[model samples]
Target: MRPAAPEDEPALDAFFGHVDAEDLRFRFLSAVRKVDHDQLKAMVTIDHDRTEHFLAFDPASGQIIATAMLAADQSFRRAEVAIAVHRDFKRMGISWTLLDHVAEFARWKGILTLESIESRDNHDAIDLERERGWIASACPGDPTSTILRMTL
Candidate 1:
């Protein structure tokens, strides 16, 4: 795992495209209305140029299999983490590695907390977040969505 660079955009897109549209919806629900190239770019690289993007690559192929974006708010004391892994790479410990590094980055930066909101229907994701000690909250009238937070 490493910080993403400007040159990593194409690989990032490719990795994202490996997951089906329905998978994306299941993970984010209506919170993410669409997943277009511009949206992917913005989520993966357009924020902080240096340290916010974390990627997992296969050393044998030099191909990124997963990515997590940790973008700090204006205060720089907390961040929102968004993670995505290629469908083929799911359950291979890539998300765990990415999330672990994201926590390490937050610790290094003296951040207070890391937050991730996943759809309630995305049980795998919810379970992952909960296993990491994230506090979960539900969206009113929406049983399919949840907000999770972890103190750094």
Candidate 2:
């Protein structure tokens, strides 16, 4: 895994394109048909101190297969974490490792809490978060979604 640079936009776009549709919905909490260039640029043009993006590449193909992002608030006491792994790369422990990495990164930045907002239908991700000791609860007034929180 490595910090995402502006030049990695194309690879990031391709990585998003390679992700499953359902996974995309789970990641964005929307029915995203295609990831636009502007969105890709936003992902790559992060400010490392408050917002960090990381990409995991496939050793054999050298293609990006997973991504993790942590965005902290102005207070820097808490951060929101998000991750997406390519369809072909699922079950390879990519998400697990990325989440772990982001949690450690958040701690190093003095973030006191890490949170993930996920769709209720995303059972696998919820399970994984639970396995990592994240507390899960329903998102307020949103029956279709859930929120997971981990205290650092």
Best by TM-score: 2
lDDT of 1 at 32: 53
Clashing residue pairs in all predictions, respectively, total 1, 0
Task: Score every model by TM-score.
Answer: 0.84, 0.98
lDDT of 1 at 60: 86
lDDT of each: 0.76, 0.94
Show where candidate 1 strays beyond 4 Å. Answer: 26-35, 43-51, 140-143
Off by over 4 Å in 2: none
lDDT of 2: 0.94
Among all windows of 10 consecutive residues in model 2, the one with the lowest summed lDDT is 33-42
Residue 29 of candidate 2: its Cα lDDT?
93
Worst 10 residues of 1 by lDDT: 42-51
* Model 1 residue pairs with clashes: 120-144
The CA lDDT at 53 in model 1 is 78
lDDT value for candidate 1? 0.76
